[model samples]
Target chain A: MEIEKPYLLFLGDAPDALAAKTAQGIVDWRRDWCVGQLRLPGCLADTGLPDLDIATARARGGKTLIVGVANAGGVLPPHWAAPIVAAIAAGMDVAAGLHMKLADNPEIAAAAAKHGRRLFDVRHSTERFATGKGVKRPGKRLLTVGTDCSVGKKYTALALERAMTARGYHADFRATGQTGVFISGRGVSVDAVVADFISGAAEWLTPANDPDHWDVVEGQGSLFHPSFAGVTLGLLHGAQPDAFVVCHEPTRTRMRGVEHRLPTIREVIDLTVQCGRLTNPDIRCVGIAVNTERLSDEEARRVIAETVRAEGLPATDPVRFGVEAIVDKIAEEFGLP
Target chain B: MEIEKPYLLFLGDAPDALAAKTAQGIVDWRRDWCVGQLRLPGCLADTGLPDLDIATARARGGKTLIVGVANAGGVLPPHWAAPIVAAIAAGMDVAAGLHMKLADNPEIAAAAAKHGRRLFDVRHSTERFATGKGVKRPGKRLLTVGTDCSVGKKYTALALERAMTARGYHADFRATGQTGVFISGRGVSVDAVVADFISGAAEWLTPANDPDHWDVVEGQGSLFHPSFAGVTLGLLHGAQPDAFVVCHEPTRTRMRGVEHRLPTIREVIDLTVQCGRLTNPDIRCVGIAVNTERLSDEEARRVIAETVRAEGLPATDPVRFGVEAIVDKIAEEFGLP
Candidate 1:
C-alpha cells in the first residue's frame, strides 16, 4: 500500500513555497528510503543533491518516483504531467503534494492506471475532525507562530520536534498545511474548514486528555496580515499552547498580500502574547526562530544573536543551526528530564 | 421553490443560543412571511407569538413548519421527532437550522419523504470559496463587532442595513452565522472553515468589484471570546470593513465559557479598531450598539444615554430604538446621501 523505496524528483522546477520543504524532508529525513532525485538535465544541478535519470534511479533500488516540489497554486502544469507520466511508464510509482490530485485528473489517472503505478496525494489529510472545545489539554502544547505566513513556522516546528525527540522528550508535529501533511502524513488543514467550526476543528486536532505529552500545533498566517490574520489567531486559540516560538524571516519587509510593512519581532511577540492571553493568560513565548536562508552563516548567527538580545529569548535558525536551544527552553519550562 | 407561507416553530425547546434567535427573527423581522408558532406544551407562552398545533396551523394558512431555535449543540432532541413527524404528516414542509439535518436522520427523512414534504436546512450554505489574498475590496464594508458572542451583532447589522437603505444607500447584510443566514438567506458561516482559508472564504463571499455598495457584515464572537474569537477576526479581515460598530451587552460581567471579565466599552472599541486596522489602516469605529435586553425600556434609554455621553458617539438599543444613530454615523463617515 505504500512505496517502500522511492526516487524523489523535482522534474521541472520547484516553487518557493514551504522553502523547498518537501524536497528537503525526503532528502534529509527520509534519505535512507530515498534512491536519489531525478531531474531534467541542468535542473537542480548545483545543489549537490543526487540527480539521476528514471532508469538509473530504479537501477539503484528505487521503486517509485515521489515528485517533491509543492509549487505555487499546487497545480501540476500540463508540461510537468508528461514527465510524471513518463516516470509511471518507467515502472515507478509517483507521488505528489499538488492541490490537484493525480487520482482526480483524468489524463494523469489514466497514465497512472495504465502503468499500475501507485499515487500519493499528500496535500491534505482525510481525517474526520470533531469540534474543538478548547479544553485544557495536558502535556505542554507548543506552537510556532510566525511574523508572516510561510515564514518557516512548519520548518522550525518540525526541527524542534526532531530536536526535542533527540533530547529524549516525546514530541509530535501537528501539520496545519499541505507541506506539513506531506512531511508528517497527518494534521488537519485548519484553513480549509468552515468558519463556524474553526475553533472546534482546532480542538479536534489537539484534544484535552493528556498531561505528559506535548502537541506542536502548526501555526498559520500572521497577526499583521490583512488577509490571513484570522487563521493565525484561530491556530493560536485552538492550540491553547502553554509556550510558543516566534518564527520570523528576517529579510522580508512588507507583509504578504498587504501594503503594510511587517511588525517588529517584539511587536509580533507582543501581539501573539496578547492574543494568547485571550484564551490562557499564563501562555509564554519560549524562543525566537529566525529563518536565515537569505543570509550567510555568519550573518544568520549575528541576526539570531541580535534577536535573542532584543527579545530576551534564545534564538536560532532551526534548520541551519538546529532547534536545540528552543527545544531545551521548552524542556526546561515543562520540567522534562 | 421557496414555501410561500410557513409557520416557524421552535419545536420542543428554545435554547438561549441566538437567544431563540430563529423564533425571534420570524416574529420580529419576517413577520409578514411567517404564519404562526408551534411549541411543545408551555414553551413560548408569554411572548404573545401565535402558538398553533400542526392541524390548526394548517387551517390558519401555514403551509410549512420551520424547526426554529438553534439548540445548544444544534442537535435535534429525541422527544421532538414526534411533533416534527406530526408536522410532516400534516403535509407541512419542515425547515431547520440545526447542525443535525432532518434529512440525515432516517425517521425524519423517511417521514418527510413519504409525505412528499420538503425539508430546509438553512444553517449552512455551500459556497466554493477562494483563498483570501488580502486584496483591497472595492466597496466599503461596515461590520458590527461585539464585546461578547451573541450580544447583538446580527440584529444591529440588520437594523443598520434597513436604516441605510431607508436613507438611499446601496447597503446589504452579509450574514456570518446561522441566525444571520436565516434572516438574510445568504452568507457563509465563517467559523466552519478550515483555519488557513477563513480569510479566503471571507474574500470569496465579498469579492472586490464594487465601490458604491456597502456590506454590513454580521460579525460573530468577540475578539476576547475564548470559544469563537477567531471567526471574529476572520470576518474582520474578509470584510476589510472601512468602518465598524461595537456591539456590547452591558450586563455581561464575564466572557462566555471563560473566567475573564468583559472589557470596557472603550476597550472593546479600541481593540476592534486596532485589529480592524490590520487589514485596513483607515478603519474607524463609528458608534456603539448597546444590547439592553436585560434593562427596562427607561433603564435601557438611561444606559444608552450614559454610553453616548461617555463614548462621544451615538449609542442605541438597535432593536428597540432602531440603528438610526449607527447608520447616520456610517452615512456621515462615507459621505453617503
Candidate 2:
C-alpha cells in the first residue's frame, strides 16, 4: 500500500519554542513535496528538558525517524532508552541519528541490533541532502583520485578542477567522499556531514536535471578510508565514468621495524583498472596527476612523464591537466566528439 | 678502508640471499643484532636503486632512511633516470628492492628524462629479527588483544576480552586503533641473491634460514589494530600488562579490510577520543585485545579471565557494558591503569 505521506519525528534538546519552530520548518518543507505531515512527538514537549522515552519509538512503525541530539547542546545521556525503544518499535528499517556519542553506548547498540536497523551517523546535515543513487548516463565521463589521509588530495583535486575549467569545458565538482572547504586558499573543515549527505543525495539525481554540468567528484583519503572507499567505488560502478585520474607521490618512506605494506601507486592504479574493467570494460585510463612536493617541477614532470609512458600511457601536465582535457580525450577515444 | 668481504652485489628477483639463508637455518639466531652489512658510498651509489641516491642520503645527514615504493616489484629499463640516478650516487643508506619491474626497457625512461647513469636495481641482503621489548611492569595493568586483520575487533575486545577480564580491579577496554601482524610480529625477508650465495657456501646451514620465515616476518600487518588498539596504546605509553595474547581468526573476512585501514586506525582512535572529549569529559577507557574465530579452552579462559582481569579491576564484565562502561567508569575515574 503506497502511503502518500511518511511521518518524520524530530527529537532534540532545543528550547521547546525554537525546537518546535525548526520542526515546523521541516514539516513545511516536506509538505511542499506532498510528503505526509511532519510532527514533533509530545514525549519531547519540554524545552531544555531530557526525555528518556525516546526508545519508545521502536514500538511505532512506518514513520520516518529523525532525532536531533544537538538540540540539547550535547550528546544523548545513557538513559535514552525510552525514545530509542519507540523508534525501534515503529519498525524503522533505517534509523539515522545525530551525535557521535551514540556509537559509544551499549544499550543503543543493543537496541539497534535487536531491531535490525542501520544507523546513519550524520556529522553534518548539509551533506545528507546529496546521498542516494544518482541518475545514470551510459556514456558519461568522470574522473577520480585519492591518497593517504592528509596527503594533499583536496589541493590536487581543486588544482585539477581549476585547470579543467580554464580549459573551457563545462565542469562541476562533486565531492564523492569526505572533503574540506578552502577558506582564503587554506583548507578548513566545513561540514563533513553535510558534504556526505549532498554527495549521497546527488547519486539519486539525474545529470539531465542539470545538463551542461560535467562532474569531477573528489574522493577523500587513501584506499582504506572507511566511508570513502565504499562510496567512491559505488559511484564509479553506478555512474560509470569514462576515464580515471590517479594522483600519487612516489617518494614517501615506510616505517622502521614495521611491515604493514601499502600497495604502490602503480599497484593501486592497476587495481582500479581491474575493478573498472570488471565493472565496465569500456572505461579507459586517461592519465595520472602527480603532486610534486619534494621534487622540482622539471623533475616532477620528467619522472611523471617517464612513469606514465613506461606504463604505456600518454602523459600530460599534471598541474595544467583539467576536466576539459579529460573530456576531450574521452570523446576522442570513444568517438563521441 | 675497503673491507675484504668484497661488497657483495645481490641482484635479480629474491636477492636477499643472506636473509634467506639465515631464515632457512643456515645461520645461528641472535637477538637485537643485525645479520648483514649495508655499505653506503661516501656519496650515494649512482644508478643502482631508487632509494640509495647520494644527494638524498646527504640531505638526511647520514641517518638511515627507510625509502622505497610501498610494494615495488619487478625490473627497470635503462632509460629510467630519476630512480636510477637517485640509487647509484648514494652516500649511506639502505635500499631494499622488492617486486621492482623496471628491468625491461629501462633506458627509455632514463633517456627521456636526460639523466646519464648506469642503473642496476639491486636488492638488499639484510634480514631483520624481532627483539621483544621485554616484560613491562607499569603502575597499573592493561591487557591488549589483537588479530592479524579485521577479525571481530569490537566483539573480541569488548565482548570477550573485556567481559571476562574486568573484575576486582579497575579495568576497561578502550580502542586505540587497528593492529596487524607485520608491525608487531617477528622475522624478515632475505634477498634471493643472498639465498643463492648461502646455498652455495652454507648449504649445511640453510634449513634454519628459509625464505618462508622471512615472508612471515614481513607479513605482520598492523601495530595499532582496532582489536589490539587498546593494548598497543598501553604498551607504547607504559601501561603494564599482566598478560597479552592475540586472537587469531582463520577466516579471510577477518583479514580483508585490514591492509588499507590498519595503518590509519591509530590516528582514527586518537581523533575520535579527542573529538569526544571536546564535548564531554566523563568518558573512561582502558586496554583492549582481539577476538578470535576459534579459541582453545585454555586460551579462551586466559584471555577472558586471568590474562585480562587478574589485576583486580572494578568491573566484572566490560564487554557487556560496551565503550560507555569503559569511558564513564574507567577513563574518567582513573589516571592510567
Candidate 3:
C-alpha cells in the first residue's frame, strides 16, 4: 500500500500529545513528507506543523490526508468525518491509523469514491500475503530486536538507516508497525495480519534487494514477551537479517502489560540467534541499543559500558548518542562501505 | 463455539476419500456423535456410516450438518447448497470446514435465518480472544510438538487423550486446527486468528482446569520451521503444557512447503522446553511420537526402539502401537493414579 506523499495530517480533537503520537513520529522521521497539520476545534495535540485547511493543504500540493491522531478506543468520532470527507472531495487520498476503517464511514467512503480518491486503513491490512518460503533472498538486512516491548527497536532501526547511509552504505528503514508504516509510507502492520501470515507479511515487507543494500527493519514484540513473541519470531524469520541489534530498556522491572520479568539482553541475543539461524545461518548480533530515558546521563553511560563489557558489543542510547558505533560495528563485521 | 452433537456428515460430491478427510477424522474419533452420512450424486467418499437423507438424519437426531469435505479451491459448489439449505430448513445447525463462510452464500444464509438456525465457518475464527498472559494456570496439560508440519501432532494429542482417559485420568483433547475442531465439536482454528491473538486463542482453548485434569492440546507447525515457528511458539506459550510429546515422521527429509531440513527430535525437545519454560517452568518431554506409516512392522519397532534409546524416553507410533508407554511415563512422572 503505497501512500501518496506530502501528507496533510489530521488530528481530530485528540486530547493530548500522546494521541498524536503517530503524526509526531512521521514528523520526527520524515518531516518533509508532511505538508501541514489539520486539527479539529478542541484538539489539544499538535505535531508543530503549519495549520492548514483542506483547500490550503491541497493548494500546497498535499496528496494525502493522514488521520494520524488516535483518540480513545482508536475510534473516529462522528464529528471528525467532515474534515476527512472534505479532503477526499478535494481530490486527496486518505489514510488512517484507527481501529475502524475509514471506508467503513459512509461519508468518507462515498467522498473518496466520488472524487476518485483512495482510502487506506493502515491499522488493517487489505493485502494478501503468501506464506513465508524461508528462501535466502538477496540483500544485507539488519533487524532491531528487543529484550521486551516498548524498547528502542524502531528508533534504533531508523537511526541505523540514517547513520549507515552517511557511511556510504545504501540503507532503508523497513517498518512493521503503524507509526513506522507512516514514516516509511508503506509496510504491513504484522500484528494486525491473520496469525498464520505473520512471517509471510514480514517477508513481503522486506523482499530481495541489492546485495549490499541494507534494510534496517523495525522489530516488534520481544521473543521473551508471551503476549507477542509470535509476531517477533515471525518477523525475525521473514527478515532473516545478517546482522541484528538487541534493544533494551534498562529501568523496567517487568515486561510491559504482563507479569513476566524482563529477560536479560544476553538471553534475547541467544534465543534470537537460535531461532534466526533457520532462515539465515550467518545471523549475528552487531550491537545493543538501550533505552535510557529514565536514567541520568552518568548512569546511562555506566550501564551501557557494563552492557558493552558484558556482551562484547557496542551499546548506546540512540536518542542521546547517535548509532555511529553500531554502524561502525556493522561495517567491520559485514565488510560494508 | 459449542457445536451441537450428533453430526450428519455431508460429503458433497467429493471425488475421493482424501477430499472427505475431515469427515473421516470425526468418524474415527467420535463415531457415536455422528448420526449418518449424507452424500450428493457422484460423491466418491464414504465414512462407513449408514446413508440417510436430510429428513431421515434429522429424525435420527442429527443436530448439526457438517460440510466436511474439501473441493478444489475450497469453494462450495452451487449444487451443494441445496442439501445444506434443506438440512437447515429441517431444523439443524450447519457447520462447515470450508474457506468461505457458510453465511456468505445468500441462499444458505436466508434458509438459516428463516429457520432460526446457526452457521459455523470452522476455518475462520469469529471469537474474540484476549492476549495470552504468561500466568501459570491450574491444570495438568500435555502438548504435542512436531519437527515439521503434518507430522501427527494432532493425532498424537488425540491418542494421548483417549489412552489417558481410559486409564482413569480426566483428559480432554483441545483442538487447534480445522479438522480437530470438527472432531472435538468446538475450537478456534488458531491459524486463522489475528497474529496478536495466536497464543490468546490457545489459552482460551485450554483454560484453567482441575489440577489433576489434563488438556491434551494439539500443536501446529514446528518450532524449527522458518515459515511457521511463530505459531508453534505462541501455541507453546499459551498451552503452557506441563508435559509435551515430540512428534516426528521417520521418512520425511525436509520441512513441508519449504526448502529446509527437518529438525531432529532432540532439537524439537530442547527448543520446546526452552520456549515452553516461559509459561510452564516444569515443562519437559515425556515421549516421542513417530509416524511409522511408511515402515514395516519390524522397521517401526526398530525405529521406535532407537528413538527411545536416543531420547531416553518412551517412543512409539501412536497409530500402530498405541500411546500406553507415553501415558505410563506421564503417570509415573506426575504420580497420577
Candidate 4:
C-alpha cells in the first residue's frame, strides 16, 4: 500500500483461473493504486480496472509495473522477461516475487540501469534461522491458521497486529511469506525452505522473549494444501502458539489444484487445533478470521455472523469491520495489557 | 572394519564421556586394526588401548590417526590441529568427523601435502537433496530408531543392511550422520542442514524406486533427544518406512547431555511410532536392534531377553548375535525373498 504512483499489473500468460490470486489480490486488497491491468487475450475480465497495453499503461501514468503472480515453485517464467524489460525501459519500476532475478539477466539489467528503474526480487531472502529446539520462551503467540494457502492469512495477521498495537498492546508482526517479507522488511519465506527446517524457521521468527507482547505470527500453506502441508505442520510445531485464529475464504468450493471439496469451518478449526497441538499440546484456536473479499460488505458481515453462530467461535471480517473485537478477545484471554 | 593399516585414535583434549562415544565406538566396533590411543593432559582414558605419543604411535605401525570425537556443532577444536599435523608429518593419514575441515586449513593442508598423507573431512558433504513430496514410493523402508543420540543407530543400521545383503536381499544402507558418511563415502549430513530440509536429505539417500529392495535408512537423533528431535521426525517422515527397528544402548542412563532419564524400551518404541506416524500413519516399530557394547555378554543377553519379553518385539545385537533374527522378521512381515 506504499505505492506512491499508479500501477499496471502485468499478468503475462497466467491462465484465467489464477488471475483471482495475485492480480485480483491487488485489485481487491490494494485496488486504489492500480490504474489498469494487462492480461493475455481472452482471459477473464476479473480485475475490473481498465485494461491497457504496455505503452498505453505507461502513458496513463502507471509508473510501476507489478508482476502480479507468484508462480508455482516461485520460478519466473522466461516468456514474461521481454514485457518486463520494456516496462523498465519505459521508466517504470518493476516488482516480482519469483525466485528468478531480473538483475541476473543482462538485457533487463542494462535497460533498468539505463532507465534508472528498480527491480524488486521479493522471494530472495538473506536471513539465517536457528533450530527451534521447542524452547519455552516467555510471552504468548497468536498465529493465524488457514484452511488453504493464501486465504488472507498475512492480511489477517497484519490487521490483528495493527489493532492490538492501536489498543496500547506490545504487538509484533512476524512475516512468513514473500508479501509479508516485503511489508515487514524481514522474514523467512517458509515455503522456499527445505522440508525439515520449516518448524525452525517459524520458531526463529516468533521468539517469545517478552511476557506482555503478542507475536502475531503469519501462517503459510494449510494442513489441507497437499503440496505444502509439511510446512504447515512445521510452522505449527515451531510457533507453539498459545492461541490461534483460523482463517478461511468462504467462497472457495475446493482446495486448490485438487478434487476434494473444502472442509467445513468447524472441521477446519478442529483440524488446525489438532495439528498445532502435535508440537504444542497447549495450543487452542481462539477465534475465526474470515476472508470475505469476494462477497459484498453486507454479505461478508452475514457470513461472519453465520460462522460465529455455527462454530461457536468468535469470528470477524477484520478487513471490513476492523480487528478490535478479536484483539480485545485475545487481550482478555491472555491477560495482555 | 575396512582398515588395512593399524590406526591410532587421537582424542585430542576430548572429555572422557564424549571420547567413549567416538573412540570407544572405533575400539568396540572396529577394534581389530587399531594399535593405540593418543590423549592430551587431563583427558580421560576410556579407549583401553595402548597409550602412545605421535612419534611412538607412528613407529609402532599406526599409519593413520583418526580424530575420535564428533563434537557438538561439528566444529573442530583448534588445539587438536597441532598434534594432527605432527601425526601427519610422522607419516600418518588424517581423519576427522568435525564440520570444520582440517583439509580447509592451509597449515594442515600443507603438512599433509608434504607428508603425502590424505586428509579425510568426513562431515563436509557435496550432496544436494530434493524435497520429500509425500509419495508412497516402491520399496519398503527399514529405519533404525534410537533411545538417544550416539546409542548405535548407525551401527545397527549398517549391521542390518550388511546382514540382509549377505543373505541375498537387495538391501541398502542409507546414512544420515558424519561417521556414516565416512563409512559410506557419500551422504547428506542431515543434522547440518537447516531446520526445514532434513526429510528431503533422507529421501534423496533412500529413493524407494524398487519394490523388491529393502532400504535400511540410518537414524540420526532420537525422538526424545531435545536438541535434534525435529531431525528425527523429518527423517522418519521422509523415509516413510513400513517397519522400523529400535536401537538402544541399555547402559544409557540419561538422554545424551540432558537431565531427562531415558525412556523405557516400550515407551521409546511407542514414541518412535507416534513421531513417524505424524507424516505416515502406517509406520510400525517391528523389532529392537540392541547395542550391548558396554555390557558383559551375559548381561547383554539378559537385557535383550528382558526387552523382547516385555515389549513382545524380537531383539538382537547385530554385533554379538548378528542381524538375522531382525532381518528374517522384516522379510517375513513384508513377504520378501
Which candidate number maximizes DockQ? 3
The candidate 3 chain A region of ten consecutive residues with least summed lDDT is: A67-76
| Pairs that collide, model 4 | A194-B196, A195-B196, A196-B195, A196-B196, A196-B197, A197-B195, A197-B196, A197-B197, A198-B196, B74-B99
| Candidate 2 Cα outliers beyond 4 Å, as residue runs | A1-123, A126-135, A138-141, A150-152, A176-212, A224-232, A255-259, A277-281, A320-328, A334-337, B1-337
Q: Per-prediction interface RMSD?
A: 2.7, 20.4, 0.6, 4.9
Residue-wise C-alpha lDDT for candidate 1, range A1-337, written one tens digit per residue: 2334655556466434343556666565556666666665434432236777777877786776676765567787677777777777878877676778878877778988887877876554354555445556666688888888878888788887777778776778877765565456445667766555566667776776457677887888888876777767777887888898989999999877666688888888888888887666779999988989999999998999998888889999887888888877877777874
Best by TM-score: 3
Q: Model 3, residue A205: displacement in angstroms?
A: 1.2
lDDT accuracy of residue A334 in candidate 1: 77
Please list the C-alpha lDDT of all candidates, in the order they appear. Answer: 0.75, 0.35, 0.92, 0.73
User: How do all the candidates rank in terms of TM-score, highest first?
Assistant: 3, 1, 4, 2
User: Could you estimate the TM-score for every candidate?
Assistant: 0.75, 0.30, 0.99, 0.66
Over the stretch B235-329, how does candidate 4's per-residue lDDT look in tens digits?
A: 77778788898888888797775455676777677766755654456888778978898899999999899988988878988888887888778
Over 4 Å off in model 3, which ranges? Answer: none
Q: How many backbone clashes does candidate 2 have?
A: 152
Predicted complex 2: DockQ: 0.01
Q: What would the per-residue lDDT of candidate 2 be over residues B1-337, giving only the tens digit for each residue?
A: 0111111222222234432221121112111121222223232222132332345334534322122222132334233334333443442222323335233344433442453322222232233212111122222322233334334443433343333344333333332221111111111221121111211111111112221111011111123332222112212222122222233342234333322223222332343232222112222224333242365655544544543454233222232324333433343444222
List ranges where model 4 is wrong by over 4 Å. Answer: A1-130, A146-148, A166-168, A190-203, A222-234, A248-281, A289-312, A315-332, B1-129, B193-197, B222-227, B248-281, B290-306, B316-322
